[model samples]
Target: MCAYAGNQRLAGVRPRRPGPPPPLDPDAPIPDDPGPLLPDDPDDLPPAPHEPSPYTEPAPETPETEPEPV
Candidate 1:
């Protein structure tokens, strides 16, 4: 079996460390509530055009076939 390049590391090699987070602003304005974008009243909305769904109606029953004699 062959060894990967990442598996072989030099004796004194240390992993890099992450820096500290930046300070926040105290005087920033509080976010306002984003209200419903759609109209509250149902009458305001346009009526949906009707289209018959294929799956809405039950499939037609198939006639039973007579069994074959042995």
Candidate 2:
């Protein structure tokens, strides 16, 4: 039981044969395609002037100070 020492299944040494299951990623995105994946390249289309979202955190400036005479 000493093919080279320690734990190949306690040194009986026959556990290294698992290599043939990985070749399906040719650009990967076709699980079955029933027809709605639309991006044939109008510049990949998704940016036509919807610009109003700078992460929105600008509403905390309330120090105008002029209401003490009523």
Candidate 3:
């Protein structure tokens, strides 16, 4: 009755330290066709739903034509 609550018969034999269970490299190259997880059936599909380019007008600062005065 004096071993820090861990002397109860050594807790039913606890000692497992085994290794070596990982070795399988048989040429590994299996990937002939793994595409399309889930996305391609919107019925006739033509409206994509991105709508953000009504002509995209936001870059009109042109004023660099001072190189022809040489």
Q: Considering lDDT, where higher is better, how would the candidates rank from best to worst?
A: 1, 2, 3
Check candidate 2 and list the clashing pairs: none
Q: Across residues 4-59, which tens digit of lDDT does each residue of candidate 3 receive?
A: 46646544555567898889789988878978766589653454457444456555
Task: Give the Å error, residue 60, model 3.
Answer: 46
Clashing pairs in 1: none
The residue-by-residue lDDT of candidate 1 on 1-66, one tens digit each, is 233346785566666688887787899888998989889997676656574444477446896687
Candidate lDDT (C-alpha), each: 0.69, 0.65, 0.61
Ranking by TM-score: 1, 3, 2
TM-score of each: 0.33, 0.22, 0.27
Cα TM-score of candidate 2: 0.22
lDDT for 37 in candidate 3 is: 66
Clashing pairs in 3: none
Candidate with top lDDT is 1
Off by over 4 Å in 1: 1-4, 29-32, 36-70
After superposing candidate 3 on the true structure, give the runs of residues whose Cα lies further than 4 Å from its correct spot: 1-12, 28-32, 43-70
Which regions of candidate 2 fall more than 4 Å away from where they truly are?
A: 1-9, 19-34, 38-50, 54-70
The count of residue-pair clashes in candidate 1 stands at 0
